[model samples]
Target: MNKLMLILLALSLLCPAIVLAKGDVNLTAPAKDQALTKLLMTRHSVRAYSDKALTLDQLSNILWAAQGINASGKKRTTASARATYPLQIYVMVKNVTGVDPGIYLYDPQNNKLTPVPKGEKRTSVVPDAVKQDWVAKTPAVIMISYSKPEKDLGDKTLMFVSVEAGAVMQNVYLMCEALGLGTCAVGGYDAKAAKEFFLLKPGEEPVLMLPIGIPAPAEPAK
Candidate 1:
């Protein structure tokens, strides 16, 4: 096995609480009887979304899907080494019902989204991501960041944090599938731009960004 794989295995053996926390949390919406298979089949990476804003419940459901705590008392939906759960999810809201437009931080501890830079949307929120048009077209963007795991853990900590982020991303996608919302996971972003946009701290580094909305319908060619 590769060195990283061996390290991961050793860590898993040493930390079971963190390992079990990585399991999937089944989505509650759309329910089991509704045949989520249909939603999965229709799921697509939508780049163009409608101008309409999302309702509170929709917003809550999607955020929960991304990284909502599974247990009432737990801090993360997925596990972390020493329960580090180093990742942070930031919501950049351009339009959503009840939620004033601005960047917000999802605090699993309080089960609430705390507003950051509230009010108007910034045009250059993220100059990176290759300046993809979808960034501006979408009403909201979710940014993932990792707070440095105990440096004593070494580079292994980064791998663990990344794996945890993957699970959270899947949760977001599945929830979007159930809710009829559109989402696209992006990694080609300018980390510097995102860091500035959120005013991230030294230890907090932006890793991924997902822009979401109700996709605009495909236009008919004349």
Candidate 2:
């Protein structure tokens, strides 16, 4: 048995969602000291975005902040259970410069984004979310799904994935704060609706969604 066959065997059991085609990586954020905590505290979820599209670099930085690889070998964020790092990051990009607008799966191992399908991200997950406006208003969103737990590891493994995702989500919040972006996490969406939308198989479950964009300006203090 070869590597590809092994992967196929594993996938047969897991039935991961439809994947995007892999492509070159775009790095957005500065190498270090991107922002401080106080600055991130001011970050809030914005419903409107500027018509001006986000640059690839900006998108890259935001995704990186969420769960990019760091320290040469390990991921930028911490994970438990032998670094299984079960959560996958998908970007539903509406108006990014240079890149085609669509749903993209982020591959941390390769630092690449794979295109799932044109318009799939927007349509598939939007209707399932309780806050439907958010899917349209924000220029981008982050979608999270988990890998099947290792056999006999039990429910504890699910908690591990949750912890890893929480850290990544906070990182995204902090980065948005520093970058003057708006974001909100929504877990109350129709998971089954979204799962079918993403064309996920039995083992993959859509767990979280985050809408991100520039906040509309505040009205004058009155």
**Stretches > 4 Å off in candidate 1:** 1-39, 117-130, 150-152, 219-222
lDDT of 1 by residue, 35-142 (tens): 666676566667777887878788888887777778756766676677777888888887788877777889876779987653246433545544787667777788
Best by TM-score: 1
lDDT of each: 0.76, 0.70
Backbone clash total, candidate 2: 1
* Model 2 root mean square deviation, Cα atoms: 20.9
**lDDT (C-alpha) at residue 138 in model 1:** 74
Per-residue CA lDDT of model 2 for 109-216, tens digit only, reads 677888875445353356655546645667777887887765545758777778778887788888787777767778878877776655454687777887777766
Candidate 2 Cα outliers beyond 4 Å, as residue runs: 1-35, 117-124, 219-222
